[model samples]
Target: MTQMTRSAVGGRLSDDKRKAIALQALARTESIRVLAERNGVSGPTVKMKTCMSRG
Candidate 1:
């Protein structure tokens, strides 16, 4: 993955946050849509994060 600059707009989530959210999804704590909405990202983004966390 390419590194994003500090000045970049609409910043991406940190790896830690992404991992936490992925874990939550795996644990069934909440719906993926809810997690994505609460995190200000799209559902697909959350889904992708979860997929990445798997491997």
Candidate 2:
């Protein structure tokens, strides 16, 4: 298998900060797709971050 580059992991938001931002976006938005697009990240990533924050 080919090795993945660091950029493949996505942008430089830290775990804590990412969770904070994702939560804020979720509160203000109704759609994960819109939030992800606005935040320049993937929908599943935002979902994962939000879920992790809740736990």
Q: In angstroms, give how far residue 25 of model 2 lies from its true place.
A: 5.0
Error of 1 at 18 (Å): 0.9
Native-to-model Cα distance after best TM-score fit, residue 15 in candidate 2, in Å: 3.6
**lDDT of candidate 2 over 1-55, digit per residue (tens):** 1113222443676777687656875686568767666566677777777777677
Q: Which ten residues in a row have the lowest lDDT in candidate 2?
A: 1-10
Best by TM-score: 1
What would the per-residue lDDT of candidate 1 be over residues 1-55, giving only the tens digit for each residue? 1113311311567878878878987887899878766776666677877898889
Score residue 9 of candidate 1 by CA lDDT.
17
Best by lDDT: 1
Q: List runs of model 1 lying over 4 Å from the truth.
A: 1-11
Alpha-carbon shift of residue 21 in model 2 (angstroms): 3.1
In model 2, what is the error at residue 51, expressed in angstroms?
Answer: 0.7
